[model samples]
Target: MPRTSTAVIARAKGAPVELATIVVPDPGPGEAVVRVQACGVCHTDLHYREGGIGEDFPYLLGHEAAGVVEEVGPGVTDVAVDDYVVLNWRAVCGQCRACRRGRPWYCFATHNATQRMALADGDPQAGTELSPALGIGAFTEFTLVAAGQCTKVDPAAKPEVAGLLGCGVMAGLGAAINTGGVTRGDSVAVIGCGGVGAAAIAGARLAGANRIIAVDLDDRKLATAQELGATHTVNGRDQDVVAAVQALTDGHGADVVIDAVGRPETWQQAFYARDLAGIVVLVGVPTPEMRIPDIPLLDVFGRGGALKSSWYGDCLPSRDFPLLIDLYLQGRLPLEAFVTETIGIGDVEAAFAKMHGGDVLRSVVTL
Candidate 1:
């Protein structure tokens, strides 16, 4: 029998999300139904609510989630029912061109559950089919997803903390370790001391980066960044970010500068804040209207470094999730610190306000 679940839904653009009764179908071929235990409230959910993502009205919002597999479709051999798992949005299809070229991390085609969950009336009440946010909507008791989307991990870890590996936390950490290639003794600077930025600091520390500079406009966030292993903190509001970063790194600039605040000004700062042959990793999502302004052609050439945009931190969910969870379990990674509060599903709207105010790291929804 199909399960009835309560989910937060954005019925229209610029509107507050409401709790709705969604009907989740049983697992189909290549699909599974997970009983969601905990889901994190992320910025993407706010983006979807504001119609920044698409006109996919009635979007089922919530993605960073950990759950237990209640049922699995035929031919699903890797995971069994009752297995604790972290739900990943990127379920790589091995036959995609990226995967075929031995770069599964850049898998071009990710899979989602084929069947659609809908209102019980069976009519298209919302005028169109509701799109699941990031293909794994978890603001409910149960969610349907591709079998490959479930990454099994140690059940001993708390769901609220472990689930974060499925999204933002993973993105930030991987941005430093995998994308930026922060090496031992390298100087790293991360702009924007949000959850992602703080995670990047932690990742740099784990990767053995000697000098980690964290920049933020808010002093509270900078303090949090410092606690997360940043060797230095720069107040973007009061100081010149690029100059401060250079001053901290023997005036040669940091070896790598990560722009965790996706804006024209921050991107410009990141471009000039790194050393020659260094990397600038842009993990922050930019608005549609935001664009880079005029820059001297000579500056681009003289920089002589890679300016890379990291999508989900170029992370392979299957490979990175478990490793991060293990790191968290062993007390090396401070995943618990990311959770500012545990909220209920109805508190998503309030969580968005806190996120906008930059008052919380993450408000996890515990089901």
Candidate 2:
């Protein structure tokens, strides 16, 4: 029997999302049906609502989810029924070129559930096909996803906090540890101290960065960054970010600078604020109209460092998800701090407002 679930949906561009009846089908081959426990309200969900991501309308909004696998399709041996799991967007195809090269994190072809969850309003028999946000549309009681999307984790971890590892938190941590390669005693400066940037700070601290500088326009966010293990904080509006970073690093500049803002100016700040032969990681998503102008060709040669953009923090869900969850279970990683508030599915629109206001690290939807 098809299951009817209350889901948040964006029917058209620039419109408010509404709670609607969504029909989720039974698990098909290579698929699974998860009883979603919690899903974080993320910027990507807002992007989908505004039609920034694609023209896929009637988008089922919500990712960054953790749930229990209620059913699994044939050939799904990795995850089993009744398993607590974190949902990930990147379910790497082992045959993809990137995976073939032993870099599954860079896998060009990630898989999602082959079948679509549909709106159950007009007809339960035939409903509108809805695009699941980031392939794991989870702001509902139940969601259909590729079996591989579900990464089984420790059952003891709280669903609300563990879900974050499925997205932003992982991206931020990966930016610092994987892309920026912040090592012991290295200096790291993270721009835009939002959830992701703050996570990057925590990742740097975990990696043993001596001077972890948090840079943001919001003092509240900077304060949160300090809680996450930042040794220094710089207000972008009050200080010259590059100079502040350099000053903190004894005028040598940070060893790595992460631009979590994804704007031209912030990227430039990241480019110039790093030490010679250092790394720069851009994890922020830029809009379509944004452009990088007047980048000096000479400086690219003179800087002699790597400038990289992180795709979901180049994370391998199978590897990083459990490890981070374990770290959270221990006293080391403070996953609970990331959850500013938890709301019902109907509160997604309001959550987006809070996100825009920069008031919360994450507003999770508890099913």
Candidate 3:
């Protein structure tokens, strides 16, 4: 039977999100229905509202989430009913080229529910289909997703904290550990110091990087970065970013520099803030209008190291989520620090306002 759920939706581009009654259908083959426990407010949700991601109106927002399996469709064995799980966007299809090559994380064809959640009867847009954000619309009391999207995690972890690993936090951590390849004695510099950048700092620390330098325009964010494992903080508003980063690294620059801002300016800073043969990882998302910086072609050839863009932090949820949760449970990772505040589903709009003012790392919606 189809059930009605109160959910957040973006009716049109740039329109404020509002609560609406949506119809969630029963899970079909390869699908599952999750009773969401907690979901985090992410900038991507804002992008969806602003039509930055697409012109898809009536989008079901919220992707970073955790929940229990309420129901599973036939042919599903990855998870069982009542199991606590973290929702992931990438439900790797084993037949994709990336998956066949033992790199499922880069899967070319991820999975989502075959059925669409619709506007409930009596609404003006009743029966209209909704495009789930990142294929995991989780802002509702219950959401339908592909069974593979649900990765079981320790039940002891707080939903607010564990849910973060579903997106931004995972992206940042993977950018450092997986993409940047930070290791013992390596010097790392992370530019941006927002939620993602701060997570990268924590990743660097966990990976045993010798010195972690955090760069940000906002002092408060930089301070937060320090608490998340940044050994030094650079206020980019007052200093030359490259010079400050190099100065902290004894003029050699960092062995690994991550740009969590995704702007061309920040990318250029990351490019120049690394030592010769050092790695530069771009984890920040750039808007469609943004173009690559025009640096001398000779410079690209001159740099002796790798330049890479990190997608979803290049993470494999099945492997990364459980390990990170274990670390968090053991008190080795400060996952709890990322939760700036918890808000009700109705408060997401206000949380977006706070995010713009740089007042919160993440405002989680507790169901």
Candidate 4:
């Protein structure tokens, strides 16, 4: 039998989300039902609300979440009932080409629960079919997801803080450690000091990068970036970012420049603010209309390094989430600082406003 639960839903584009009764199906084969303990408000969730992601209206919002496994479907053995886990959107299919090549992080076919949950009553609802945001909608009291989407972690950590490892935090950290290949003694520059960018700074520090530079238009966020272990901060509004980065790196430019802002302007800045043969990582989510303008082909040739776009920070959820949680437990990674506030499910709409105003790093919803 389907369980009735309350969830925040994006009923239509440009409209505020509504808390409604949503039906959550029982775990099907290879699936599990998670009783959400905490979920973070991410920009991607906002994008889904604004219809920037898809026409899938009435989307069951929220993805970065930590919860206890309430039940598991057939063939599920990695996790059991009552196990504490961080819900991940990318459930890798071991048989995909990327997985076969030993790069499951780039798995083309990620998995989600096979069954669909509809409105409990017979009446059809308005707006599109309630699409699960990133395949792991955790805003509800209980959510159905592929068993592989659940990555078991330490229960001792606060769910509000641990849940973040599911998305933005993981993305930023992996961009630096996995995609940018930041190493000891390397100079790293991260453009955009939001949660994702800040996480990149922490990841750089964790990876032993000697110098970490954080760039942002907001001073408050830049200050937060500093607290998270950024050695240098650049106000993008007031300075020539490329020049400032070069100055900080002994005039050659940073070894790696990550564009966490996702705009063409920042992408160009990241492109120019790196040392010769240095990597450029674009981790920000870009609007559909944005495109790269005319640029000399020779510049690309002259750059002489990889220009890569990191998807979920090139993260292999199964491998990274648990290790990150352990690091958090060991006090090596400051995951607690990411949580600005914890609110109830009803506060998500207001939280979105705070997010838009750049007032907080993250407003987590505790179920």
Write down the worst ten-residue block by lDDT for model 2. Answer: 119-128
Among these predicted structures, which one has the highest lDDT?
Answer: 3
Between candidates 2 and 4, which one is better according to TM-score? 2
Per-residue lDDT value at 312 in model 2: 96
- In candidate 2 the C-alpha lDDT for residue 347 amounts to 96
Output the lDDT of residue 27, model 1: 91
* RMSD in Å for model 3: 0.6
| Pairs in steric clash, model 2 | none
lDDT of 3 by residue, 89-174 (tens): 99999998899999998999998999999999989999999999999999999999999999999999999999999999999999
User: What is candidate 2's local distance difference test score?
Assistant: 0.93
Task: Candidate 1: give the clashing pairs.
Answer: none
Question: How many residue pairs clash per model?
Answer: 0, 0, 0, 0
Candidate 2, residues 242-342: lDDT per residue as tens digits?
99999999898899999998999999999989999989899999999999858889999998989899999999999999999999888799999999999
* lDDT, residue 242, candidate 2: 90
RMSD of each predicted structure = 1.4, 1.3, 0.6, 1.4
Q: What is the lDDT of residue 295 in candidate 2?
A: 81
Give residue 303's error in model 3 in angstroms: 1.8
Best by TM-score: 3
Q: Per-model C-alpha lDDT, please? A: 0.91, 0.93, 0.95, 0.92
